[model samples]
Target: MFSPEGPTLRELAVQALSSVEHGYDLLAPKFDHTPFRTPDTVLESVAKALGPLGPFEDGLDLCCGTGAGTDVLAGLCHRSVTGVDFSAGMLDVARRRATGPVERVPAGPGTPGVAWVRGDARALPFTAAFDLVVSFGAFGHFLPRELPGLFTQVHSVLRPGGRFAFPVLAPPRPASPAFWMLLGFDAVMRVRNAVWRPPFVMYYRAFRLGQVLEELTRAGFTVDLRALPEFGRRDGGSPRARLVVARRPDGATPPPAA
Candidate 1:
């Protein structure tokens, strides 16, 4: 669902037919008004979960779209916060939106410092510099094959014992309408890519938890999943939402080939 200011059906069609980067560049201006942006509630919940893990000196928001996850980092981090995104248009929006201090409960002090950078997540520019890193609602942009390199980059940026966190929602049931909707969307994307020039890469069901853990481990991260009880559990007893904390070891290995 999109707001009145969100992209039109025709605009969305144009974006879907373009490359992933180009589509995000086109959508970035009105992205926050669309359902694709990570919601404030999810951001807040993640902040609450990560708060105790911090008072961290520095934090980074990976693939920070409009800096939603950056806002969360600002709260938990003590000295500085950085939001990095590949799309310049998206970075512009994030810079504007994350300019002021973030709002928080109990009327306490605002977040740590904030900055925005335009860069690819697969090739982060920082070293063992950040105490924490978080991303939200941006995984769909990356194809399954890219996950290892992406994870490795994030791990490379984080300081020893630092976390690379993100929330993963359980996939909709096969019999559910949401599942059918995603299936149809993916089918349309397949058709469009067959005849189109640049391919947009976003798939609802491709990023499986098992595959993710394997990649994270291969990327030199010790992975753990903490169930987000607020979202409850599925019929098979799996969590509806999970906070994945992937930690790069103190002596992390050099990143493998892309």
Candidate 2:
């Protein structure tokens, strides 16, 4: 669903036909008005879930679009928060937001400073610089085969014992309309990519949780899952949403922070 201020259907068509980076650049200005942006409720829930596990220092928001998750990190991290994304348009919006009078979670006397950088997720440009890394609603751009390298990049940016955290929703039941909708969306995308240049990679079903956990483990993280009770349980009593907290072992030595 999109608000009146959101991109027009024609504008969305143009974006969908563009490369992922360019598409986001075109959509960046009105991104928050679209349902495509992560909901504030989810951000608040994740912040609450991560509160106890942190008193973190520097933090990074990987693939941060418009800086919602970075705002969460500003409250939790004491030193500094950096938001990195591949889209210059998105980064521009994020930068303006950091200096604006938006209502953000109050971060006490040591509120971390915020910075925005442009970089690809597959090759993050930081060295053991973050004690915590959080991402929200951006993984679908990456293919399943890219998970290992992506996780490795996340691992490389974190200090020893640092966490790479994100929230993931449980897949819809096959019987549900939502399931068919997502299936159809993915099918359309596949067909489009088959004929289109500069493939726009967004798939609802590609990021399987089980495969993701295995990749995180293979990438050297001690993975843990925490249920976000706010979203409530499904008919089967399983959590509808969960937070994945993957920590780099404290014993592993990493290069000095850049």
List the global CA lDDT of all models.
Answer: 0.83, 0.91
Tens digits of per-residue lDDT for model 1 on 8-114? 99999888877787888899899999998888878887888888777688889999878888878877887778888888888888877765543322233554667
Please provide, for model 2 over 100-176, each residue's C-alpha lDDT reduced to its tens digit, 9 standing for 90 to 100.
Answer: 33333334567777778889999888899899999999999999999988998899989998999999999999999
lDDT of 2 at 215: 90
Q: How close is candidate 2 to the true structure, as a TM-score?
A: 0.94
Q: Least lDDT summed over 10 consecutive residues: which range in candidate 2? A: 99-108
Question: Cα RMSD to native, each candidate?
Answer: 3.4, 3.5
Over 4 Å off, model 2: 100-108, 253-258
Candidate 1 Cα misplacement greater than 4 A, ranges: 101-111
Q: Quote the lDDT for 124 in model 1.
A: 88
- How high is the lDDT of residue 221 in model 2? 90
| 222: Cα error in model 1, Å | 0.9
Looking at model 1, residue 106 earns an lDDT score of 23
Find the 10 residues in a row with the least total lDDT in model 1: 101-110
In candidate 1 the C-alpha lDDT for residue 248 amounts to 79
